[model samples]
Target: MATQVTFSEVKNNGLGYWGVLGFFGLLVLGGVFAFLHMHEGHYTTGMNNQVVWGIPHVFAIFLIVAASGAANIATIGTVFGQDVYKPQGRLSLALAGSLLFGGLVVLLLDLGSLGHVIEMAKGALNFKSIFAWNMILYSGFLLIITLYNWTMMDRRKIAKKLYKPLGIVNMAWRFMLTMGTGSIFGFLVARQYYDAAILAPLFIVSSYVFGTAIYSLVLMASFKLTGRDLGDIVLNRLRNSMAVYLVLVLFFEMTRHLTNLYATEHHAVEAYILTGDSIFTSLFWYGQIILGSLVPMFLVWCRFFKNNRLAHVTAAVLAVIGGMIQIYVILIGGQSFPLILFPNAEVSSAFFDGVNNAYTATMSEYLLGIGGVGLAVALVIVGMKGLRLLPTSLADDVIDPLNLEKK
Candidate 1:
């Protein structure tokens, strides 16, 4: 048997490390702006009745989607019987749990009341509400994944037997959680841009793409920073997987928009996203397509730089940047367009009813969104420092002996 890879805690012994932590701390301080919004009211933010969800939702939803995707790494090892991925199991689990927590923090802060959340926790919730269902799903996901991660680390025979079942359950639950999240927008009946069934599956595939990208970057950075060896075999496997996911995500996007464009009723929203000179158009074309998809794809698939480490980093960074732009377009751009309340007649009202309502994000919204990202990074840092999350090395000879065996 291959020598079982050992897990060790990251060394927390540098000014550079402290500086990174301080940077995340500054981001968390941005939450003071969130507190101001909460105390003063939603009026303080760009969100109004029309654009009910703003930049915060963009960040929160992305983090949540990425969280679900991050868990895929562990699932490949435990559920798929892929021993090549087994060494990555612990770090994957830690990142998944931490990302979810960060997202939930942003989401909860955005809610109307802290007391309402307390009440909901006390079982004063509407089970019929998708929001409530998500709360359950999110909470249950954390609990089950924590247990699952524990089982993976436990060597007791009882824990071993329980491990596979828990892994299967974790996978199923995460799918449900992400599907529920997509349904938040997918089920918006009043919104012309949102009422599509494809959003759920699209979100699922998107989670895979964005989540894998984040994981690959974190893995590389962690290894490099800690002076550990991470091999080309693993990097190639991960980047290739990300490339496949990117293609799938692009397919889903084409299906979504093409299906929408086929209907005359959907033409206006498509025009807003694809043809207009607005920020949404630029973000979709440049950020999502060019920088996010095409460029990263080239970096990974290019034969000349297949094994180059810098190529891997560039692809991962661009993939993450593109993922953010995609979410922003979906959340804010979808809301930015006028609602077609009267199909046959032009309408106007004080609430900007049936007209394109501009959502100009304020400093507070930007800070809060940045804070959400900061929260995720902070959680990752803390997990690495506090737990035995990082492995000593992932050199090809150490982790990829299975390939030799197969040959």
Candidate 2:
């Protein structure tokens, strides 16, 4: 059966008008920033030999992880057959796909040579290298999402029958691609993050949490900006899932640290992250643990979290902010903490040094990083407005328009 509509187009038209304007305004600002930097080269940013990966890496990783995560929201309805999630599926796909556009923008800027990236894409790829595999997988993922979206738009009359197989195919591909992303960070045998076999799973799990959190915030913003209600069924469904997701993330987070605590080689790094007399300690304790983890959890824990829309929205916004901080800690902190000891790999210089000499991001690094974020945000806004994600639905309680006209 076809689900025709509820949300009034007149109201949506108004929102769409202003939303599009705001969206493009941001895109223009980001484009200006990007254009100026493109000519300057990556050297315009903070990245250097000491701290090679900076903010761009942080946001790009977050975007990709968020992109993979978006599937969880869509799949629960399509693949797993949970109807409550149905309302949000299309929006989820749009958000995930859109976020990817933002990620690519930052990554392109981060690469010292856009010219080389083009050659690499056209040239041969070694499947053994995670970078090569990621290039292929990301392209494939983008293609699948584009196709999935096109088919959905055309098949609105009977959305399920036409899209079922596509949904399954998309899921399988995303799982592999997400694994590819994790492998990029996970296989770093030279670093503290690599030794634990659990990093891959961690990325996969956290991707969903981050995806939903980001989507939730955008959903609220879109709804408020447009004056629409996403329907109680959709919101309620998402609320419980959000809570469970947070719980799962916290659990894995605890487990990851516990594992490190047990491993002798990784122990020093974990100590530096957890309680070391270093900057990482502030990031972990203040940013990740407190602002990112605890405060949000406490908000979600309140009985009013589900009942009050603002509380729910707040939880999501905080979670997204915290997740970003966590990403920095994982990527920057892990790299900066130094492996301290090399068991399997031989090293010529292992003499008088501590974590003090470990690498850190520089000023150009911060500028480049901020630029990536601007690009991602601009992408999300443009994609949402250009694409028809924000459907004109008043609420789940409203009678179907098709049924109403029949009467």
Candidate 3:
């Protein structure tokens, strides 16, 4: 008979844990300071009339989309009946909720005032706006995930019965949340870069890539720190899954760019992003394509690095960096591109019309974005500390009963 897998709270109250806590605490503080500073005046930051959504939005959107993606592990285990993934479902759900909260924090702060956020929360919503719809989606995601976690953690018989059903609901909700986020940009018909239906699916696939990368890294780090038995079977599965997501995201991205290039009206923006002498061009080709997608793919598939833990870690880290750069290119680059206010007509405006908008991220903006990440990590750590979110062992024999039979 296979040994039963047990779950436990993280008990490492050592120097390393405290040090990490302190570091993330500082990051959260920095984000608070940035919000206060920016709240003083929008002029304090790099945002202008042309480029409204700045670096914070990039981070916010990335985390929000990634939150949906991170839940994929739990979805696979419960919805698909994958036993190998079941062990990590608790951690997956916890991480998903934490990431969403962190991302929402940054988003609310960046909206410019506490009062505005309060009013929105108090039911002052414009139903016509996609943003309003997303507010509901985000709230529903948190509530559903919370309840799902309860079902997973509770010992009640009813909870066990509801687990798969809740997982299915959470999976559907996550898809809608991510699609809504992508639609925020896709619905912008005036923007040459974002006016594509492909964005919804593109973001969905991109979430898979980014979320899986982040989850792999966090899982590895947690198991390593806690001295848990994290077997190669789990790591290999995550690595292979990430590789597939990378290919899908790349395909979607290629389709998006190709569709843009095919349209004569979008040629200028395409040239600017793809071939122009700008940071976006470098980030797209070097950061997103080569280092982010291709290199990670090579690392995972190369026989030389097979079963190599360090290689997997490097690939996950690179994927994360590449994912962030990809979001930057999409969110910031899209806004920086000149708007087509007057097609085929000589138009001049004092508000820097007919030219690419200039934007340089301030230190405050970087802090706020980094803070959101720190908050997410911190929340996961705290959740693990208070709850039995991690399996005591994820050894091949433990997760896969077939391994025991073979042995």
Candidate 4:
């Protein structure tokens, strides 16, 4: 018989918990200050007409994409009937919701005015705009996730019956949400880097990679600090899953670049990103490819570190860092490449046409991005405290009883 898993709120009310709260609170304050500073004048920031979406977009997009991916755990457990993953459903949903909130907070604040958001909420939306579609998609995601969470937590027979159905809806909504996010760029036909249709699928896969990494890190940390039994079985499963997603992301990335290389029209932008003597090239090769994908792949799959918890943790951290760099390259690097106003003709203009746009992020941008992350993590911590999201234990025997019986 399988061991019945029980859930409980985190019992850690010590200085450690308070310290974490205090630290993230300060970060949130910093983000608010950054927003206020930028509100004084858009001229104070590093953004320009060419590069409007800066570091904050990178962080916001990552959080948003990861939010969709984070819910996959719950989807697998409930929709697919994965017994090992069922106990993790609540935490997964919580994290998904919290991450979305954090990402949206950054995105809204980055707009430079609360009034703009309010106006959008109160005013008419252009149906033709992808941004308008995204507004609907995001709001729908939150609603569906909330409903799914209720089904998971409720013990009534009706709620149990609704679980799988709600899971399916949530899963589909997440895919649409991620795809909508990708389409934001994919629909930008004017930009050299943003016109690819593959971006939709690429973003979907990326969400898997980044989301799983963040979830693993949070799971490990929460279990360790709260003195819960986090088993090798669960960790190993997550490690293997993340490794698979990493490979998919790499494949998609390669395909995207190779497709761009194959096209005559995209040649200039490809050269700029791949071979140019710029930070994008270094970040692509070193930060995204080497450190993010390859290193984590080796760490997670290597037999030497198969059972090493630290190695797994390190891999998760690297994956998150690599994910951020990947987004930066996509958003900033793509915007930095000069737009080809006239194909096959050299055009010069007073607005610095035909030349790469220069942008350097200010401290305010960095603070806002970091603050978004802090908010996401802090929400997770608080959720664990107030709700019975986490299982009492995730021991190998508890999570995988068949293996224990076999042993």
- Considering summed lDDT, which 10 consecutive residues are worst modelled in model 2? 398-407
lDDT for every model? 0.86, 0.68, 0.90, 0.90
Better of 1 and 4 by lDDT: 4
- Whole-model lDDT, candidate 4? 0.90
Q: Arrange candidates by TM-score, highest first: which order?
A: 4, 3, 1, 2
Residue 90 of candidate 2: its Cα lDDT? 66
Instruction: List the candidates' TM-scores in order.
Output: 0.95, 0.85, 0.97, 0.97
The superposed Cα distance between candidate 3 and the true structure at residue 340, in angstroms, equals 0.8
| Alpha carbon lDDT at 300, candidate 3 | 95
Off by over 4 Å in 1: 1-3, 402-407
RMSD list, candidates in order:
1.8, 4.5, 1.6, 1.4
lDDT of 3 at 407: 17
lDDT of 4 at 45: 86
In model 4, pairs of residues that clash are none
State each candidate's clash count: 0, 7, 0, 0
* After superposition, candidate 3 runs with Cα above 4 Å error: 1-3, 404-407
How many clashes does the backbone of model 2 have?
7
For model 1, residues 23-85, the per-residue Cα lDDT tens digits are 888998887566566558888888888888988888889989999999999899899988767
TM-score for candidate 3, please give it: 0.97
